[model samples]
Target chain A: MADRRYTKTHEWVTVDGKTVTVGITDYAQSQLGDVVFLELPSPGRTLGVRESFGVVESVKAASDLYSPVAGKVSAVNEKLSAKPELVNSDPYGDGWIMKLELTGELPPDLLDEAEYKKVTEAGAH
Target chain B: MVDFGGWELPQQYTSIRNEHLAVRKVAGLFDISHMGRLVVEGPGAEASLQWLMTNDLAPLAPGHAMYTLMCKEDGGAIDDLVVYRESKDRFLVVVNAANRAKDTAWMQEHLAGSATIEDHTKDMSLIAFQGPRAHELLPKGSSKTDDIPYFGFRAGKVAGESALISRTGYTGEDGFELFVDSGGVGEVWDAILAAGKAQGVLPAGLGARDATRLEAALRLYGNDMDETVNPYEAGLGWTVKLGKPDFIGRDALAKVKAEGARRSLVGMRTEPGSIPRHGAAVSHDGHHVGTVTSGTHSFFLGHPIALAMVEGPSFRVGERVTIEVRGREAPADVVKLPFYRGSARSAVAPAKP
Candidate 1:
């Protein structure tokens, strides 16, 4: 969890060496209740930092999933197409949206766990 | 929680999907106290209401109810409401909460010689016990809750509280709406919840309510139609009794009837992955046809459904249409009104759809 970085848009990325895993934070999933569907970029798509890579849809709304770091898409979680509710039930683990292999620089504005928690807490009110 | 017409209410108590399924398979309770409850009584009650409303209440004997609309002189909707004939000289008019003030002023301004109007909205608590299992959950004293026919009300004691149990609901299910004193509402609400908890009855909220009503294709006043929309175009032409001698909007409605609607309300269905939100644009073959009036991801029906006011005489059933969802034109099929039906259809009533 300490390795995870978050964007103001509510997406989180965990970088381990050259490969990074991406998903929405638990706070994001709670705000968008009952995820029903997801649209993820397939392997080989190049994404710049902060670019919209896909979409996450819940019963309440549809939000764009932005990339926190510049990278080339390596894989998308196929588990989501069969069960999107994972985004609501286990947003940080099984709900992980995609994995990317780093190709470009990481966004400097990405927040660490403590910083992201502060951002989400401020929005709760 | 959100403020709905000055009443604080949650969009979903548990979850919209779970609460919606409870109403479909078991039961769900809702606090519908926001709806305006007005009592009109006196010798002229029947005649005055008949003149103001589109439905002729002449044959509406006491103990019966009729769904009708009140319109402006231009035939645009004032409000869609249900009038319950309680007795020969008294009637109860339930109207939309947002239109309470407007409806009251309109009714009073057009008041006739004998009848009087009283707003009981602040004095009464309205609870909807809706679902297929609704009848099984009501308090079992006199067992009168089971006897009230659809749209019919019976004054009785429920959970030891004086109540008027009416077999009616906005959900497309067999249900009873209980009207009780506002001060003692919590007692009755708790009693009903305790009784039905074992059967998966949930305290539902606005989210589930909106979804169920959309599946049934019941029009919401402000969303589906308003002061500028007429009955013929809002898919409620059946509630207009043009045969009646005279009403506030009779002349204009007659003209519309003779000429036919240029744009009419129609139902549209999309796949499971996408939802049609309100105010989304509806298009056909790259041309903007109309706009979505009301829409939701129907948790019970398992498909996203919508009601749109499209250019009529052209948008027929089975025609493929498109809705702009998230900046993309999502494909949808134009279907019949009432994306689904339930036990409420079993009761004898005016034609639906």
Candidate 2:
């Protein structure tokens, strides 16, 4: 597994070769409460860095899911259609939202584990 | 946590889904101190309130409570509240937290005769214990709660602390809402949780409270009705008493009742994953007809449900409607109010002619 990188918006990405896996951090899922539904882009759709790719609907509210890096959508977690709660239970594993075929160099602004910790800490209050 | 009516409150103690199910299957405790509490007392208390509230309070004897609406002269609802008749000279009016200040002023401005109103919300603590097993699991140290009929309240002792226990709740379940001194409420709260811990009584929060109330089809103030929405249009016509000789909005409400309200509140259901949200547009045959007021995913019902304020004639049960979800229109069905029924002793507010 590669080192996980994060965005200030609370999404996390892990890059391996040319494929990058994306999911929201544990803190993000906790703040969102239960995950009820998610609308994701179909395969082959290209996404721009920082662009909103889809929506995540919880019981309390709906939030937009932002792309952390520019890439072509390769796959989405089809299981979420039937079992969205996985996002709350295992956000980093089976709850992985989508895999992106890296289109350009990973965004320079993506924070490493240590820097993302500071961002989450500042938001916790 | 979220800011609700100037109060910093948690949306859920844990997960909203767990807490919501706890209230339906076992029991859930909620700290609802944010709701406003007012005491109206004087020789003219009854007469004064009867004229201000839309519901006829003549039949509400001491120890009983009734749900009512306070309206403007134009028939728009100012607020919806529960009036508890403590006695012929004293009454307790509980109003929504967000409208506390406005309601307090309205009551004072409309004061008639010798009645005086005092705001008691800041000094009292309110807690709600609700579910099928709530009655059996409550920590009633010295209070005789068994005889307290639905909507009835009495001064009593719970967990050795003096409190006013009312048999009422927003959730569609048998429950009690306890009014205790702010200083002593912690003891009572702890005692109930300790006594019911083994029985699955969870401390719920605003999220669970909102979900359960929506499932019960209880109209939420501001969301379902406001100063611009009249009682008849909000499906709360039953709370209005046109027969009353004179009241603030009696004449206007009577007109709406006779001429028929232009819009009506109705329940709609959608498939899983297509949850409708507040302010979403509702249409039939591609024509805009309404907007969603309150909506959520009913975990117990395994589907999404909503309340919409629709224009023109009311839709019949099973009629088809489409709601805008995520920028696209999704098909929905006009279903019955209260998508599901729980163990509530009686309907919160019955629809009567």
Candidate 3:
């Protein structure tokens, strides 16, 4: 959890050596209630930092899923295609959207946990 | 929370999917106080309403309610509403929240008789208790609810508070809509939840309400029809009684009916993960034909459904169409209105125009 970094757009990222995993934060999922379907990028697709990779559709509206770090998609959570509600039930565990083979240094704007808490608090109002 | 028609209301209390399934399988309670309620009464109430509404009010006796539409002179719908005949000289007209001010002003400007209208929205609260098990789960000892037929209402007491209990709902389910004093509504809300908890009744919100109503093929005023869309085109021609002597839009509506509506509303279904949205383009054979008015992933039906208003000839059932979803055209099947039938008991079913 401490290694996890967040973006202002509410995506979270964590690095294990050069593999960076990404997913939407709990706050983001809470705001977009009852996710019904997600259009996820396929493995082997390249993405740039802060670039939209796919869409997340909820009952209320559709939202874009952005990449936190630049790299080629190594894997997509295929489970999400079948059980999109996982994004709401367990946002961090089974809901991790994709993993990237890191292509460059981590972005400088990623916020740490404590800093991300402030961002969520600011948005709560 | 979302700002809906100037009211801050929850889109869903917990989850839209859960609340929707609860209504289909058990029961769900909804706080619909934001809808506008008006009281019309006097010696000329019936005649005044008869001239204002498109539906024939003479057939709707006391204790019954009828769905009607108010249209502009050009036949475009101003709002769709329900008129409840409380008695010979009293009526309750429930209008959409967004169109409340406009509807009130229109009625006041066109009021031609001794009938008087009063805005009772702020003075009372409206709640919908709906589902298959609603009658069994309704709070015990409520008077006069046993024999209230579909679309019929009775003045009764719920949770020790005097309320108007109506056997009506937007969802295609057997349910009751309660009109209670605002001061006492909280108690009534709590009592129903506490009594029905064991039966898995959840306090639903706007999201579930919209989804269930869409499945029922009930039109949402602002989304499905507006001042530019006429009743005949919105699959609501049934609400327009051409036989009625004279109404505001009767001439225009009759003309449209005789000439036939240029566009028609049709239901379509798509595969899972391809949710159609409002304003999405609908096409046939690569030719643009229509736009989606309402759509959602139906958990109960295990697929996505959409209502589209299309041009040219109406598509036959089983015909294929394409709807733009997230910038791409997806194949969908033209289905019948009301993707699914629920437990509602009604005299007339919504028909395809």
Q: TM-score of A-chain in each prediction?
A: 0.96, 0.97, 0.97
Q: What is the lDDT of residue A70 in candidate 1?
A: 87
Interface RMSD of 3: 0.7
Per-residue lDDT of B126-213 in model 3, one digit per residue for the tens?
Answer: 9999998888787865675658888999999987899999989998998899999999999999999999999899999999998999
DockQ of each: 0.56, 0.69, 0.87
Worst 10 residues of 2 chain B by lDDT: B344-353
The top-ranked prediction according to TM-score is 3
Stretches of candidate 1 off by over 4 Å are: A104-106, B139-142, B347-353
Q: How would you encode candidate 1's per-residue C-alpha lDDT over A12-102 as one tens digit per residue?
A: 8898889999999999988887787898898999999888998888777889989888889999999999788888788899999999999
Ranking by lDDT: 2, 3, 1
> Candidate 1 at residue B169, lDDT?
92
Q: Top model by DockQ, which number?
A: 3
Error of 1 at B273 (Å): 2.2
Colliding pairs, model 3:
none
TM-score of 3: 0.96
Which residue runs of candidate 3 sit more than 4 Å off their true CA positions?
A: B346-353
TM-score per candidate: 0.94, 0.94, 0.96
- State the interface C-alpha RMSD of candidate 2: 1.1
